[model samples]
Target: MRIGFGIDFHQLVEGRDLWIGGVKIPHHKGSLGHSDADVLLHAICDALLGALALGDIGMHFPNTDPAYKGIDSKILLQRTYELIKARNYRVVNVDSSICLEAPKIKKYSDQMRSIIAGILEITGQEVSVKATTTETMGFVGREEGLVAYATVLLEPVKVI
Candidate 1:
């Protein structure tokens, strides 16, 4: 068994769709980035990469590259999955947390879980997502941006 931890944050911007964990959410502002800027997905991607001793999301998908502009993050997640599989690893489970003040995430937590789980081909019970507030203390508390942290477990496949 292997364990990896990852974290990501993104600034909020107007005139963009709010996306998290591959699901669009109703919100006034969305994360700004070359990709969909799904902070949660990015964090999970990093955790998966870290688990396999691979470089990182930026190494695989550079923001400086135009091809990734406005790209959906699920593609990145899929690519990450492939990278792990190439190393003969399979996901055991993942636990993640989102930090934001505005937009209570409780309502959409289940939806986010379902979407991410489907992409990972894992049961919802294996992927845990939790949200919390910083108590009006930082960028997330001020609603300027959102942050996510993820920890994942991966198991090495037995070679036939």
Candidate 2:
């Protein structure tokens, strides 16, 4: 078994759509980035990539490339899946957490899990998502941004 971890953060800015865990939640502001800027998905993608010792998301999907301009993060996730599979690694499970200050995410947790699990080709139960606030302490507490963390377990193609 192999383990990998990843974390991502995005600043909230006006005139953007709020997308979390593949679900669009009603909010006044959204994360700012070259892509849809789904922080949760970004973290998950990094985790998967890291598990294989390949690299992080930015290495494979650079923000400077127009090909990924305003791209859907799900597509990036799919491509990451292909890369890991090419190396004969299979995702066993994933766990993640989101830290934000507004617009609670409890209701969308299940949907996020389902979407991520489906993309990773694992059971929904194999993916878990949790949410929390920063208690108004720092950037997240001040509603300036949101961050997410993800960890994944993977198994090689064949056992010893």
Candidate 3:
């Protein structure tokens, strides 16, 4: 089994829609980025890519590319998983955590898990999503932005 870990952060700004783990969340400010700025999904994608030593999301989906501008992060996640599948690797499970300061997200955990599982073609039970507050300590606590961390376990598609 191979273990991969990834983390992502995005600044929060007004006038953008907040998306996390493919779930559109209601919030005063949204993550700022070239894409829909779903930090959670981005982190997951990075983790999957890292598991295969394929580099990070930016290498595959460069922000300078207009094609990815304002795109949905869910699509990115799907494509990342496709790369993994092409290499004959399958995700055994994924665990993730989102850290923020405002607009509690406890209620959205299940939905996030479901969405992630669907995209990864795995069972919801194999995907775990969690949320936490920064306790007003740093950038996340100051409400400047949000961050997400993801770890994934991968195994060969077939035993050799």
lDDT per prediction? Answer: 0.90, 0.92, 0.95
Winner on lDDT between 1 and 2 is 2
Order the candidates by TM-score, highest first — what do you get? 3, 2, 1
What value does the lDDT take at residue 62 in candidate 3? 99
88 in model 2: Cα distance from truth in Å? 0.9
lDDT of 3 by residue, 26-143 (tens): 9999999999999999999999999989999999999999999999999999999999999999999999999999888889889999999999989999999989997899999999
Q: lDDT: which candidate is best?
A: 3
For 1-160, candidate 2 gives per-residue lDDT tens digits of 8898989999999899988888888999999999999999999999998888889999999999999988989988889999988988899999999999998989889999999988999999999999999899999999999999999999987857
User: What are the per-residue Cα lDDT tens digits for candidate 1 across 1-160?
Assistant: 8898889999988898888888888999999999999999999999999987787889999999999999999999988988888888888898999998878888888988888888787899998999999999988878899999999999988999
TM-score list, all predictions? 0.96, 0.97, 0.98
lDDT of 3 at 50: 93
Spell out the clash pairs found in candidate 2. Answer: none
Q: Is candidate 2 or candidate 3 better by TM-score?
A: 3
Superposed model 2: Cα runs more than 4 Å off: none
Clashes of each: 0, 0, 0
lDDT of 2 at 19: 89
Model 1 spans with C-alpha error above 4 angstroms: none
